[model samples]
Target chain A: DQQVKQNSPSLSVQEGRISILNCDYTNSMFDYFLWYKKYPAEGPTFLISISSIKDKNEDGRFTVFLNKSAKHLSLHIVPSQPGDSAVYFCAADDTANTGNQFYFGTGTSLTVIP
Target chain B: DVKVTQSSRYLVKRTGEKVFLECVQDMDHENMFWYRQDPGLGLRLIYFSYDVKMKEKGDIPEGYSVSREKKERFSLILESASTNQTSMYLCASRRGGSTYGYTFGSGTRLTVV
Candidate 1:
């Protein structure tokens, strides 16, 4: 069974509009979450992350919101730029493991139209 | 800056041939991971290591093996290549525990003919 899930396979947004990417987790054991943006032929780059203790974490134009009660998380990119297009992956870590091995979601391809 | 380097950008091997993919990290990360990404299937972890000479099987370790003899390098080996194994392989490394994020390398596109 997939513990971390990103149900949306693709999302598109107009430039200067807000783009929201949603993720859900079934494993309550997960205590940390992260988002990574990947471009073709390259590895995923770290975008933002949040600990289970906090409800939200924001960095510049990127914001990650965690709703513990709903077992859901969402990433919002305000005024989306065309350069923001890529495949975004959501990941969760098992707190007990000191190795930082993560469970990853399928990913969502986001396209920003100019 | 942290950087993970994969040895090959693209490789083509014939069926039944052995293949090797290498990854090196200059960031001195204690943890290294090998993952394969397929179209629509996403990234699936194959193997990982936390320290030198120590390895662990991830979700899908079949037909694959890994070695970490030194702290700076990790190698993934395919005993015998198969067409089904043709996919993009990613290597990543990170500091210990849940505090930091991973630094990944440019993927290697392996095609087994």
Candidate 2:
């Protein structure tokens, strides 16, 4: 069973526009959520993270919003740049169940067209 | 900076051969993981070790095994390589806590012919 799921397989956005990538999880025990970006032939790098205690977290042009009630989270990149084009993965972890073991989504390929 | 180094960037092995993928982390992290990424499959954990000599099986560990002899190294072994096992393998390490994210090494692309 896939605990974490990224419904959109890919997304294309114009440069300088807002790009939203969404994720959903079935496990209610998950308290920590994170987003990672991966370029071709490279490892996925951590972009942002949000804890269940907070509804939203932001860093520079990236923001992550978590909705516990809906079991959904979204990563938004403001003024998306061509450099942001890569595969985005959303991950969830239930610390109480399995510490530091995260469930990853299939990932969404984001393209920032310049 | 934390550094996780994978021994090989790419490897080609014949089917039915034993294959070993090695990972070393310089941060002395207690937790290390082996994951294989396939198209539309995301990252599937094959094995993980939270402490030296302690191993845990992940969601997909059917044909994979792991070893953690030292605190800085984790090795993933395929008893017998299969064509279906060809994928990009990623190694990651993190401290034993939920607050920190994982640091991944540049993945190794393994091909079994």
Candidate 3:
């Protein structure tokens, strides 16, 4: 069973425009959510994160919004740049478990067209 | 800066051969994980260790095993490589008792022929 899912496989946006990538999860036990960006051959780097207690968190050009009631979350990038083009993955952390296992979505490939 | 290093960026092995993937973290993170990324399937955890010598099976661990002899090093082993096991293997580490995100290595692209 896939607890976390990214419905969209890819998204393309014009540079300087807003890019929104959405994610959904079925498990309510998740308390932390994070977004990671990955280039072609590089590993994923953490972009932003939001706690379930808060509805939103922002870092400069990046922001993450969590809607616990809807079991959904979205990552928004303002003034999207060509450098931001990469595969974005949304992950949920289950801290209740000893392993602190994280569930990741299928990932959305974002393309910033210049 | 904290870093997670994967031994090989790319590897190729014949079917039925044993394969080993090594990972080391400089952050001294207590939690280490091995995940395989496949298209449309996302990142599937193969195994993880929260402490040295202690490991737990993740969502997918049927054909894979792991070893954590030290807090900073984690190894993923394939008993018998199969073509189906070809994927991008990523190693990640996180500090204990932290809800923060994990630091991932560059990832190893393994191909089993």
lDDT of each residue in B2-32, candidate 2, tens digit only? 7999999999999999999999999978899
Against the reference, the lDDT scores of all candidates come to 0.94, 0.94, 0.94
Q: Candidate 2 chain A — worst ten consecutive residues by lDDT sum?
A: A93-102
Give candidate 1's iRMS in Å, 1 decimal. 1.3
Chain A: TM-score in each model = 0.97, 0.98, 0.98
lDDT of 1 at B67: 91
For model 2, residues A7-103, the per-residue Cα lDDT tens digits are 9999999999999999999999999999999998899999999999999999999999999999999999998999999999999988876547889
Note the residue pairs that clash in candidate 1: none
Candidate 3 per-residue lDDT over residues B4-112, each given as its tens digit: 9999999999999999999999997999999999988889999999999999999999999999998889999999999999999999999888988899999999999
CA lDDT of A79 in candidate 1? 82
**lDDT, candidate 1, B6-109, per-residue tens:** 99999999999999999999988899999999878889999999999999999999999999999999999999999999999999999886478788999999
The number of clashing residue pairs in each candidate reads 0, 0, 0
Task: Identify the runs in model 1 with alpha carbons over 4 angstroms from their true place.
Answer: none
User: What DockQ would you assign to candidate 1?
Assistant: 0.77
Q: What is the lDDT of residue B1 in candidate 3?
A: 76
| TM-score of each model, paired residue for residue | 0.97, 0.98, 0.98
What TM-score does candidate 1 get on C-alpha atoms? 0.97
